[model samples]
Target: MEYEAATRHFAALGHPGRLSVVRLLLRHAPRGVRPTEIAGTLGMKSNTLSHHLAELEGAGLIGSAREGRSLFYTVRLPELAALIAYLGQDCGRGRPDLMPTHPTEIDMDRPFNVLFICSGNSARSIFAEAILRSLGGTRFRAFSAGTRPNSVLNPFAIEVLERNGLDTSGLRSKHVAEFEGPEAPRMDFVFTVCDQAASDECAPWPGQPLTAHWGMPDPAKAEGTDAEKGLAFAKAFGELHRRISAFTQLPFDQLERLALQQHLDRLGEA
Candidate 1:
């Protein structure tokens, strides 16, 4: 980062309002928030929020994307990281404690709680919960939920899990709200397993959990004979299994938050 560029970034965040905006955006990283929601959450007038957003974007501290009719804003993590690095460039000279450490380094002794989400809790998300439950052993606790959940679990999904020797007795469809309340478990990670759910406006999860989109084809929408539908569900199961297996094998204690997030986004592509 050039000194000039660093100065620009600092200038953008110099205002109290702008700094608050940046903090809120960081909490919702990887999931862009719409301008209306930002305004509502921060109690800022639309005109004022727009000015701040423009300034942040001009400084490359934030970025936006058009999703359908809405423009969503997200913090540019790499740029922010560069600014932090520029500030702390010489921290190791004498202040070893001032050097940054990975968040997971302090939490490695406890099991991580992971939540998988989808449009319907019936299929893909459920498959993920089961796969992680079986593969993660005591190192991870997996949960699943939906944005608009069906009343019952998808039969084909259950069939596929049973065929693969996974327990299905306790699995059922659940709303995302179930996990959003004050009483809900704090999640270490949250993943969206379908494109529709990924694009939906989700409530800000408690704990500001690390999130990623891991979209897969919806097997519940699969049309064919029972055998073919079962195959579709089985394929979904395999894909989630592969992803979760890779996730469990990650070196959490060694990777920083940003690096861990990058690995998660890459797994979605895989």
Candidate 2:
């Protein structure tokens, strides 16, 4: 197994703001930035940015060294290299032309493609897909669609995603039928996060991707005042965050099909 510290490092970098900070450091490699300067440049409050910086440092992406009374943060080249190597640890396999120098530890010769299915594909499923897309690395790709499609993406869904720093400009809603065609994209995993979509029997497909039910409650169905509705969205967001963390943490290579199935089945059980 690769270093656990390195995985935590990658997890810390998964956040959009943190990813931006890392990119900034990469652009200014060798030359370190001070905490105050970083906060000012990112337009983030000193306290908020400091918390994020500390997390990055804990993950070993950035190193802090004291310079007189000030602390300077510099990108750690070896750490960055390790992160890249970890993500690419399972690159090309069985093909001479596609051999990868930095293969990921997890099996990525076939990057797992996951599809999230739900009734409307407006709130819960869309949120799950976006969270995975934002959190999951190159080893996994995520898509979502509704069994009975909606004409538009839910406004609240877009709001929550954007608040979490995900770009919703490119997201769209579609019917599950789109994936049934012969030319549809290959799926390695299919998850129905709502009870309705999980029970529906549908057409067969290639790979016969493993199926699981997450039973995430529908935020859109929440009724009452604006505050109550917002609470529903918050609840859904927290649930998705917890679930996505567990899903990406899976060691696909180490587990057999049955074990993997059991692991996925137990997700969100708590």
Candidate 3:
């Protein structure tokens, strides 16, 4: 970072309110926190929180995105990394112990929590959840939800899973809100398997999981004879199986956050 840039970031952090905002954002990390949540947590009035957020954003310490009716603020990891590097540049000269270390590994002590989302919890997202459940073994715990979940799982989706020897007894459509509460499992990754769900506004996930759009055509929309509709569901299952298989093969312990994010985005295109 340039001297001017470093000074600007330092100036931004000079205020106690701005520093507190940064700390709160860091706790949320990759996932964005809504302004209301931030204000509530910090006990800052709306106008005061807005000013601090703007200052931090202007200094490149944070970024924001609009999701439905909510605006979410997230820490700018690269910029934060650069600022830390600038501050610790001299630490390598003699005191290596004082130098910062970047985390390249994810916690492996517990099974990684994964969520698959769609507009309806009927087919694509359900298939993904099941595929991951079977293939992921003890390494992953998978869940699925929808923006506007149907009353039940799509019959074709269930048939396809059964034909492939996947368990369907406990599977059911679920609203995304079910996973947004404080008691919900903290997801490590969340994927949207259809365009509608990818574009829909969703509640911010609890853990601010790494997210990506893995959109595919909705198999339930197929109109044809039973065999043809079943074929469509089968095709959807095949695509999801391929993606989830690739996801499980990633070198989680070796890739850092940015690299892993890039990998996830590319998987959507694949």
Candidate 4:
């Protein structure tokens, strides 16, 4: 594949939600996942999961078939193999010693570690963490924590995520203090997804990561029928998806720290 084609493929796999789907398929390998199971597992709605599944299928990373009322999907192993081989198509052809390297030791797929903070960790922050991680893929590692975490995820959040067929397994609300100690991972970016978390003065941030406030409306606060709540969650996910897609496409190496920060500010506004 050409570089552009490869980049697009990588970009397609960038979202944390999409990556979750890809990982699931890869884990299952020869046996594909069915649409209903995917939806039920992720707490997503059937229609929304279909959209994400279609995107994966379009990227040539997955294949699907219909069995009665259900649709099954499988990871296309050969397609993944071809993509890997294309990355090294010209290896050692000229200066084998001159292969491009990352500016830092961290994997490009695992660009700056990200942490999303909020008060409850029940809705918006969880959405941000999952969507950003799935959408950003390995380009960034995303996590969520609350100043005072809830015991369980919001049911609506679970509903929407499952509808989109994202992996909701092993997810739990966490206290922000867990990330404040000396042993915490160095965060490249720290975002507060709610006003309270943004304005909190007691947070003991260690590394002074680039901090930003993204005041996303609470999905839990959404008042409506189940369908309405799902729509709100979907809207929030789409907004984050768009902003993040733009941010990830920028040439970070060419931008100064201040410029990059400014760009991120604009992204938050988006």
lDDT of every predicted structure (CA atoms)? 0.86, 0.76, 0.85, 0.71
Q: Which ten residues in a row have the lowest lDDT in candidate 1?
A: 90-99
What TM-score should be assigned to candidate 4? 0.56
User: Please, what are the lDDT tens digits per residue for candidate 2 over residues 127-162?
Assistant: 888888888878788898898855578888888888
The deviation in Å at residue 136 for candidate 2 is 1.1
lDDT of 3 by residue, 1-270 (tens): 888999999999999999988977764555577888788877899999999999999999999999899899988989988888887783344356767554455677899999999988988999999999999999999999998855568899999999999998789899998898888898899988876675466666654567777878898888989999999999999999998999999998888777898898788778
Q: In model 2, which regions exceed 4 Å deviation?
A: 1-107
Better of 1 and 2 by TM-score: 1
Q: RMSD of each candidate?
A: 6.5, 17.5, 8.7, 17.2
Candidate 2, residue 83: the lDDT equals 63
* Cα lDDT of model 1 by residue, 51-97, tens digit: 99999999999999998999999999889988887767643443546
lDDT tens string, model 4, 1-270? 666667767877887777767765653444556777666656678887788888888888889988788778987877776676665554444354544332232234446788888888877778778777677766787888887754568887888777877778867888887777778887877877765565444454555566556666766777879888888878877776676678667776677665666677677666
The order of the candidates by lDDT, greatest first, is 1, 3, 2, 4
User: Which parts of model 3 have CA positions greater than 4 angstroms off?
Assistant: 1-105
Query: Where's the lowest-lDDT run of ten residues in candidate 2?
Result: 98-107
Give me candidate 3's TM-score against the actual structure.
Answer: 0.63
- lDDT score, candidate 4, position 261: 65
TM-scores, all candidates, are 0.67, 0.59, 0.63, 0.56
